[model samples]
Target: MGVNISKGFLLVLVGLFAYLSLLLVLPFSQYVLGAILIAYVLYPLQQRLEERVAPPIAAFALVGLAVAGFVVPLVVIVAAIASDARRLLEQVNTDSIQLGELERAIEEQTGQTVDLPSALADAAQNVGTMVLESSTEWFSAITHTLIGLGLAIFLLYYLLKDGSDLLTWMRELTPLPDDVQDDFYQELDEVMWAVLAGHVMIAIIQGTLAGLGLLATGVPNAAFWTAIMIILSLIPLIGSFMVWGPAVIYLFLIEEPLLAVALFVYSMIVVGLSDDYLRPILVDRYAELNPAVIILGVLGGVYAFGVMGLFYGPVVLGALIAVLDVMNDHYDRLADEPGMR
Candidate 1:
């Protein structure tokens, strides 16, 4: 009786500590998860580098490359976009642009009065103001930003350098048989590749192609619209249409019907067809995710983890599917065993 009581008390203690530990880590969950994902993506590079250099040196080289190649360009692009948006708002507010012309055109077409200029001005102002405020707020929180960034860097380095040992440790801790664990790892590898290479790479290509179309059609602020298209392209069932669609309407409103028709045709033929053609070469060759899974994952992930959640959401869903598959196999094996029957 006493031994049983001690065991119960011990289990309670473990549970309490586990919950507390989770609470402590919850605030920095984004940084931790971001580091893990980035490390996983860069691991191949790390391996190649380590073949010629030490592990720590390889890890450092990769981190430095990421800072220069990814982080720096991202910061510059965002700053430029924000500046352009502000300028656009100013241009929209100016009387010389004849915003009334578009409103008149719309009213003439639909036989209904619409304050399109005021609505557009209000939207531009809000977007510009929001972006400027966000930039200011981010700069103001320098301490917190630095801390999160430093944590990501530190974690990233260790993961890149010691990922194999970490995998071994996890394998030891997992209670599953070796073959089941191997299957889980294999499924996970394919899914991650699908998310990164399949979804992300395809989005980039599609967005760039749409951007070129925008440029060819002589759309105003093509760079900014291109950036927006790239982001919208990340969402399943919604692609570059959100930006080009408005541009088409605007072109028609401005009496550029020829340009508008050209854009519409180009978008349908080039932009729309790209997915059908490229998806098989990129994603279908590896693993395919159901569109529903990706959609739900993206929505729920963004709600939970902000921008980073986009990648993490689908990954979580993929991991869940893998677990379910493994469980199904386990139960099948159990049913096949004859001792109980």
Candidate 2:
């Protein structure tokens, strides 16, 4: 009875501390996960670099490379987005948005008048006002953003340098058999590649195609919008339509009916449907994940983890699938091994 009480007390302490620990790290969870994902992807290059240099040097060099390749481009794109956003706000506030054709069509068909320009102008005002009002919060977030970035870089450096050792330590801690662990690792690696290669490649293709339509329609800053489309395409349900859809409307508002129709058709048939056909061929080759899994992941992940959930959601599902696969195979073999029940 005394031993049972002692054990219960110890369990309570463990659970209490575990919950506290989680609370401590919860705010920075995304940054931590992002560093892990980036490290996983770059580990191969780190290995190659280590062939000619020390681990620390290799890691430092790769981190610099990552900063240049990933961080620099993102910073440039963000600045461009801000510039474009300001210009767009000015245009929206000043320009007479043409909706006469649509208004006439609506009145002719439905026998009702619609004040699209007034409604749009009101919406733009609300959006601009909200942004201005929230500027203080945005400024405050910069400090947090810098901290997260610094943490990610610091963690990434060590992850690259001692990642193998860390993995070995983790492997030792797990009670699973070697073969089962191996299977789990293999599945995870494949899923990582699937997310990076299959999903990202599709985004790039859709974005590029959408950009071509924008350029053909003579939209200003087509390249900037294209880059935005590429990023938006990473989200499953929304895809690249967020950008090109607006472009279609913009063309119509500018009274380019033929170009608007052409863009709408091209984006719908080409940019939109490309993933419907290509996903099975590409993602299946690597992860064999169902489309539904990814869809659910995106929905749930976004609700739970914000923007980073886009990457996390699919990976969580993939890990679950891997666990299930390993469990099934391992137990099936064990059951088949013959026994005195």
Candidate 3:
């Protein structure tokens, strides 16, 4: 008994040491986590491609296509934006045409002086500073992009090449029974699929609708605004609102009441439907998680992990809930056994 106790104590110590070591290596851990997620997202496509060809080459080509699909457009957009950004900034700063109608309309509406010249000066100064700061940041980003991309590509390639074997090895390492392991993986898969399907679909729909609305209403920089809306739409609750609110206010200030109303109506219909209705439906269909669990997971994940937390947070929460559910099932079964009480 004493020897057994000593061995158990040593095991506990080793586990604690490993946990602390992981904490110490969290930056690398985050990258690994990100790679795992990317691999998981792309695995189905890889498998489909493998069905048609050799596994190794299929994996490489699939990852390459995925990388190109993401990187090429991103590079092109960034390059174009970088090239045009300075000219745009100069235009914004140098152009000083007064919005006489806007000022008069604002004064009429609010009984305020509406100091147009002072505001324009302030706006130009802000714009100029923003332009300078953004250019510097973009240059820094460009320097880092190659290094990051190389690392992501390497990790993705290895993950795609050996992911199945790695998963099998991990499954073997788990001390849990096979049933428990299966349950955990099942829950994890459901959560990931739900998040991927719900978030991506909703973002695309919202972005498309926003772009269409902007184009229909003759808004300048519609594509930029639409892109911004799509990115913002990843956040829960107040995503698209952030993009459309200022736009509507600007339209109102410019006395484009009809355009403002149309934009508002269209945004309400499309954005609202996608986020409020469609997303939840997909999540529910896939995850079967309690609403409270979903909300807490999202809020907690965001609080702890920033943007990526949205994907990882709910998954962790779902796994926890799944574990508890399994425990409850066993407990209830044991309680129902004859003479158990």
Using TM-score as the measure, which candidate wins?
A: 1
For candidate 2, the TM-score is: 0.76
Query: lDDT per residue, candidate 1, 250-318, as tens digits?
Result: 899999999999999998899999989988888875668888888888889999888788888988999
For model 2, which pairs clash? none
For model 2, residues 41-125, the per-residue Cα lDDT tens digits are 8999999999999999999998998888887877876786687678878877434644787799889999988998898899999
Backbone clashes in model 1, listed as residue pairs: none
Instruction: State which candidate, 1 or 3, has the greater lDDT.
Output: 1
lDDT, candidate 2, at 316: 87
Alpha-carbon local distance difference test for all models:
0.85, 0.85, 0.74
Q: Estimate each model's TM-score.
A: 0.78, 0.76, 0.72
Q: What is the C-alpha RMSD of each candidate to the true structure, in Å?
A: 7.2, 7.5, 7.5
Q: How many clashes (backbone atoms < 3 Å, residues ≥3 apart in a chain or on different chains) does model 1 have?
A: 0
Clash tally, candidates in order: 0, 0, 0
